[model samples]
Target: MESSLLLIQLLNGLQLGILLFLLSAGLTLTFGIMDFVNLAHGSLYMLGAFLCASLTLYSGSFVLAVLLALPLTALAGFALEKIVVRHLYERNHLDHVLATFGLILCLDTLAHLIWGPAGIAIPLPDTLNGQVELLTGVVVPTFRLLIIGTGLLAALGLYLLVNHTRIGMLIRAGASNRTMVGALGVDISTLFSGVFALGAALAGLAGMLVAPIAEASIGMGNDIIITTFVVIIIGGIGSMKGAFLAALLIGLIDTLGRSFLDDLFKLLMSTEAAETAAPAVSAMLVYLLMAAVLAVRPQGLFPPLSR
Candidate 1:
């Protein structure tokens, strides 16, 4: 039973890691290249889940809702960049933080007005609603496995887009030195806008995937965005490789810590004391991990080559 529980927790961690990767992939790109601090990124995530929920109900197919919501989320991000984000780009990081926080409030209020204050639950098709046993005794949800699969495919696609394509070359160049890329006639503004939209889409994808389990509601992105920041920070601000691995590491540590920390503590101390301390320590595990990482490698585990 313990082994089975461990396997299940492992899968849970992977699912969460994949979701974080989806979010941090875009965020790291935007942060690395555009140097923009977007506190409202979670708003995009919330929007994606709500959009998927609405579309799923309207279209009667979970898959189709995802397809439809993705582009719409991207468009929303594009419009946001052109209208509001672009204006703040020239400002300092503090201004970026303040403005984006305001944007978060605005976006959350808008979501509340449109989707109502209640959380919206997403439905899955039969194929994705069942459970499967990957190991002798460990059963996992089909939807969670699908999320992991989709996130892996997305990571691969992003890898190809960033490393192999011409646009990717331009992206790297811009990240290293935007002024030089702009001087070379690369149309930096448009590139950054596209990057921002891509980030939004990735964030939205995370939301859509999570909604079936967590539901879609106003300010849904608020808490997760903090974790997302930790991911990018631990992975390195501009490093996709860092983001991917760090997210997985953090996810595993978080899940396993929350699941079994008390047991480990009980081995060391009394059961009551262990129970009292476990929850608080488990909650701090990620931050503690972050602090440890900073102490050892301030630049992160895998900083971008340019950095």
Candidate 2:
């Protein structure tokens, strides 16, 4: 039974890590390649969840709602870049941070005014509402399995796009040296816009996917965005491979810590003492890990090779 419980928690950690990957993928790209500091990325995630939930509720079809949300979020991303983000690309990081921070405040307020203060719950599709027995007696939710599959697929697709394609060549060059790419006659503005849109769409997709589990709320983005940032940092900025690995590691450490830390502590201390110290220790585990990693390798586990 303990083994089964451990396996279940591991799966849970993987699911959480996968969601972080979706969010951090875009964030790392934008910050690593474009050098843009987008503090409002979390707002995009929150907005995507709310929009997807609203559409799913109205359309009465979960599949269609997800399909619809992707493009809609992409469009929203494009519009945001064209209108506001583009202006900050050439500016310093401080300016980018301030402008995007204002954006967060505005977007959150707008969400509250539009959707009210209550959270929205998305009903699970019939196809994914059941649990699957992976072994003789161990069971897992179909939705969580879907999330794992979807995240892996996205990672594979992103790998191919970044490594095998012509545009990807340009993106790589741009990441290494933006001026050289412009000198090569590539349309830098359009490329940046596309990258920004792609990032937004990824974040949105993550939000939508997790909505059924966490519910759609105005401040949902803030809750997970910090974790996403941690994933990016631990993985190394601008390194997708690092992001993927680091996310899983952080997830496992976090989930397992929260679940088992108290029990482990009780073996060494009184139950009351263990309970009192476990929560704080577990909560700080990731940050402690991050600091340890940074102290050893300041650039992170897998910083971009180009850098």
Candidate 3:
């Protein structure tokens, strides 16, 4: 029974890790390449979920809603870059932070105005509403499996884009040296806008995909944004490979810790003590890990090359 439970928890961790990756990949890319501090990126994610939910309801088709939401989210991202973000690029990090923070407030207010203060629940398609059995009769939700699959696919695509494509090369170059890339005749402004849009699109997709399982709520992005920051920090900022690995590691650690920490504590302490301590301790695991990483490797697990 214990082993079976452990397996289920591990699967849960994998699912969570993949979702984090989907959200963190774009964040790392945008920050790494454009050197933009976009706290409002999470708003893009919220927008995706809200748009998907609304469109799904209006169109009466889950697939159609998702397909439509992607482009819309990308366009929103582009407009944001053109209108708000471009001005901040020449400013200092503090200014960028302040501007993006303000944007988050505005986006949240707009979302509430459009979608209402109460959160909306995204209904899963009937086909993905149930569980599927894995080996040894362990069952997991189909929606979770779908999230994991989509996240992994996104990571793979991102890996290829960054390491193989022309724009990706420019992005990496920009990350290492923006002035040099600009001097080399690459259109830096266009590149930044493109990367920002791409990041927003990825965040949107994550929001849309996870909405059915997690539920869409006001300030939902706040929690995930923090998690995404931890993922990127632990994985090494600007390193997609690091983000992928760190995201999975954090996910597994968090999920398994939440599921089994009480049992582990019970082995060493009274039941009541274990119960009281388990939640607090489990919640601290990721932050503790982050602190440990920062203490030992301030540059992150896989620091990008400095130009």
Of the candidates shown, which would achieve the greatest TM-score relative to the real structure?
A: 1
* TM-score winner between candidates 1 and 3: 1
In order of appearance, the predictions have TM-scores of 0.98, 0.98, 0.97
**lDDT per model vs. reference:** 0.94, 0.90, 0.89
lDDT of 1 by residue, 105-163 (tens): 99999999999999999988999999998988888988989999999999999999999
Please write out the lDDT profile of model 2 over residues 187-266, one tens digit for every residue: 99999999999999999989998999889998888878888888888999889899999999998999999999999999
Cα-based lDDT at residue 262, candidate 1: 98
User: Clashing pairs in model 1?
Assistant: none
Candidate 2 lDDT? 0.90
TM-score of the candidate numbered 2?
0.98
Estimate candidate 3's alpha-carbon lDDT, on a 0 to 1 scale: 0.89
Candidate 1 overall lDDT versus native? 0.94
- TM-score for candidate 1, residues paired by index: 0.98
Model 3 over residues 1-307: C-alpha lDDT tens digits? Answer: 6777788889889988988888888888888877877888889999999999999889988889999999999999999999999998878889998999999999999999999999888877789888888867688888888888888898888889989999889988899999999999989999998989999999999999878877777787878898899999998888888888999999999999998899999999999999999999999999999999999999889877671
Name the 10 consecutive residues with the lowest summed lDDT in model 2. 132-141
Over 4 Å off in model 3, which ranges? none
Of candidates 2 and 1, the better by TM-score: 1
Per-residue error for 189 in candidate 3, Å, reads 1.0
